[model samples]
Target: MIRGVRGATTVAENNDVEIIKATDELVKEMISKNHIAATDVAQVLISVTNDLDAVFPAAALRKIEGWSFVPVMCMQEIPVPNSLRKCIRVMMTVNTSIPQENINHIYLGNAVSLRPDLKAE
Candidate 1:
């Protein structure tokens, strides 16, 4: 069965380095927490707030080894009123035997406020 690993993180600024660094950190933490290897990831869809356009989150993900083969796409998040700012959210499709309930969803940095109910244990 396929499982989805969801995560979100906020970048301090809209720059290539900061966008890449923040995304890399969030992706790493999500993968580690879910025990997912790059080989298991089928694809990743990344959406960033409108204010963030310096770099694509997928580009940052490519900086990780073994991530080159995994299909990744980037889009702009809807700028809803009162929504989180400088936020980049990722939904990763993975080929895994684990059930959906057991999948770990990660929210880091200021993005943590976006999903407080699933706050990491």
Candidate 2:
């Protein structure tokens, strides 16, 4: 079966280094812990707040080992009033034999406070 893993993270600034580092770390952790290999990933969609540029995040994922084959796309999140700033959200679909509850959906850094209900237990 195919299962989806959802996660979101934030960057302290709009700088390229911070964006790349945070995105790489988040994607790496989700795939590694869930035993989801690049070949198994069906698609990876990333949405960044309108405040961010998508190039850095896309480049970050491509730089990672084995991620070259995975299809990735980036989009801008709608600017809702009072929304979080500098946020990067990722939705990934991968072929998995495990149940959804067994998956570890990551929310790290500033994004942790956003989803108090699902913080790492």
TM-scores, each model vs. reference: 0.94, 0.92
- lDDT by residue (9-104, candidate 1, tens digit) is 998889999999989998998888888889988899999999999988788788888889999999999889999899999999998887887878
TM-score: model 2 vs. ground truth: 0.92
lDDT of each: 0.89, 0.86
Q: Residue-wise lDDT of candidate 2 within 1-121, one digit each (tens)? A: 9999988999888888888998999888787778788898999999999888745587878988888988999889999999889999999999999888887888988888778777654
Clashes of each: 0, 0
What overall lDDT, based on C-alpha atoms, would model 2 receive against the true structure?
A: 0.86
RMSD in Å for all candidates: 1.0, 1.4
